[model samples]
Target: MTHASKTTTKLAEEYATPIFDHLTGHDDALYIPLLNHAQSQGDVSPVINLVRNEENFPYAIAHPLTGIICLLAVAESAYWVPIDRIAHSESCSSCAPIWRDLKNRVRTLKPGETFYAAATTHSPMGETRILIDAEDLEN
Candidate 1:
């Protein structure tokens, strides 16, 4: 490979290790489960989720009048399916109540909200996901 191309590849590899990719999942498991995983892993950086709707994670922007502006995106999907096996085997109907709760609670989450845990990964329905037994998590 050319020197420039090699450099670019190396940079990509270096950066890709930290990036987490998630799939179209039911409910906002990204915030609940993923967030919990990152926290357990001692990830100090904001959960950089790279799937559900592209967004910048904890990237700051400078402002002339103000000091600075920081933006964060919660990588949460808006879909929750029933647990009925007749349709989807990966149904989350058992967590229907939680989904309803999140439906209301998530709206109150601001982009600049402070948080302790956040995670992102490319796991399909069959793959294992980090889970926490906490009843509620508030930022």
Candidate 2:
């Protein structure tokens, strides 16, 4: 496994909360669950009023090795799925709608799963999104 993966895994275990890929940006809706988990773990605050200003268990900004921003959301939260697009461009390339496929993909996500979608060398704006359980995604 890459050092970043190892670091993230270790951090996840230590924090006992899921760390999501941050490509979707900072949405309060997503932060709620994460804060709840931390609060449950004895964190003084339950709601994260300010992510950048956090004092305890600050959410990681990026994977240590991969340098990918980690979004982080609590498991089982009713969150909005990010819009999927082609690898390079921000536009969707599907002639036929793939809504069902995307929906199914999101539905299958569990607590320990890490959904990674980001740019790669081969494809600058990599379109392919990978959903691997925390156990399976380890480098």
**Overall lDDT per candidate, in order of appearance:** 0.27, 0.30
RMSD to native for every prediction?
Answer: 17.9, 15.1
Candidate 1: residue pairs that collide: 21-121, 34-119, 35-118
Q: Which stretches of candidate 2 lie over 4 Å from their true place?
A: 1-28, 31-50, 54-60, 71-102, 106-139
Whole-model lDDT, model 1? 0.27
**Tens-digit lDDT track for model 1 on 9-38?**
454334222222212232233233223222
> For candidate 1, which ten residues in a row score worst on lDDT?
79-88
Q: Best-fitting candidate, measured by lDDT?
A: 2
Report the Cα lDDT for residue 14, model 2: 46
Judged by whole-model lDDT over C-alpha atoms, candidate 2 comes out at 0.30
User: 23-125 in candidate 2: lDDT tens per residue?
Assistant: 2234423222211221224632122222232453323333333344333322232111111110111122321233333334445766544244233221112
Model 1 TM-score is 0.21
